[model samples]
Target: MTSTAINFNQVAYLLITGASRGIGQRMAIETSRKFKPGSIVVLLARSASGLESTRAEILECNPHINVVTSSVDLSNASKQLLEDIIDKSLSKTPVGSFELAAIIHNVGTIGNVERKAVDMSDRQEWEEYFATNLFTVGVLNSCFLQKFRECAKKLVVNVTSKACLVPFKSMGFYCAGKAAREMYFKVLADEENDLVVLNYSPGPVDTDMTVDIQGRSNAEEIRNYFKGLRETTTILTTHQTTEKFISILEAGRFSSGDHVDYYD
Candidate 1:
């Protein structure tokens, strides 16, 4: 892996999706503290109240930082709608006002983990899954690039998963979505040499999603695997995983587009 120096102190425009709770909320608040005063932080999610809670916490951390929260349903949003949301969020602060522009694509769905691969015959189901996990990501990244093209440094982060490489039975939708999303960012990195793109796998953190998987996965082995992590007290807390994530961003090492894990 290669290392590059990133100045975290610079004024920045940071946008994070799925910022209502879990890793996204934690990351949004933690990363906000690292920015200079007058920096902008845009939080997007379906839950309006949750985003407000995140915004409140961010303001509490640094009242000087500008925080904008928008409720967006990524699952069914049209490309034009996504672009409009981006425009509305970015309009809170002037365009050429930041030295660094970064977006963390943390929004996603687990899909129907109860259904196995052979049962996944509905094209609508697949399209909905890809809409949230893949299509919106590409649309948002393209809009971000165009809006912040003048920034001195650009960072794009895809919150990827180990499932992207390793298959998990009964998790066909989730695994496939993650795999496609990861490759999407890798290609983005290849095409945009000046951008710093990272596919970060935050490991099995103790979140509601993990709890859902533990109880809901159709595969007994998969359920047991997550249950074991919880039982052993090995599942990482949101704060713990966010600490590692922040360190990785601050360090700015690892070649762009490399799939870096929390353990790594």
Candidate 2:
């Protein structure tokens, strides 16, 4: 990941899901640079090696920052599991180390882009997708708030998409999941006066997920659209988009629960 000069607020503890690669990994490394020394960073992903690489990049940016990587699949996440992860991840930090906490709910799956809306009728498949995309996000956010209740300032971010606002061909599962996840955070922001919650759409980032959409989407137009982006070199790099995301946090002008896109 290429380093950028974006400086963020000094959060005491930060948690990032889907931190194994792409935007998540870069986000972790970049944000870790501005956190206070000795602050704890918890990274969750299914790939041990990817998490390790992310941890290494974080340490390289700020050696004093503490990074804890967990290889847990979000598809199987539970309240207890999430709570335990936070407790264990923050176990080493001293009391009253810092006053701020933040978490970015970034994990999501595209879910067989080759399947059209009608083909998404399998109950078992829907269950699995929701378990990872919707269920885990809610449980993890709740766990984070409870675990870090003492922190004076809390920020919760849901990495959302344009699909949440508009329908896309062959993206039934992804669009539904994103919409639900975005609304969940919107509700949380309305209910929780003590936290700053945001639904951030990262734009058309060039990642492995994009590659899947480009190669396997059932809609020819959708595949051609993504292919055209690559051909035109218009796809946003992970670093470029992440820089925008961090800058949004630094600006702090957006209202809580607002859906902010990179283009915005």
Residue 97 C-alpha lDDT in model 1:
86
Which residue pairs show collisions in model 2?
none
Q: lDDT score, residue 55, model 2?
A: 98
Q: Estimate each model's TM-score.
A: 0.96, 0.95
Clashes per candidate, residues 3 or more apart or on different chains: 0, 0
Reference-based lDDT, residue 16, model 2: 96
Candidate-wise lDDT, in order: 0.88, 0.87
Distance from true location, Cα of 256 in model 1, Å: 0.7
- Top candidate on lDDT is 1
Q: Per-residue CA lDDT of candidate 1, range 1-264, in tens?
A: 223445668788999999999999999999898889878899999999999999999999888888988898988777788677768766767777888889999997888989999999999999989988998888888988988887778889999999999999989999999999999899988887788998989999999898888889999999999989989999999999889988887787788888999998
Q: Please provide, for model 2 over 95-183, each residue's C-alpha lDDT reduced to its tens digit, 9 standing for 90 to 100.
A: 35765688999999998787888878799999999999999889898888887787767889899999999999999999999999999
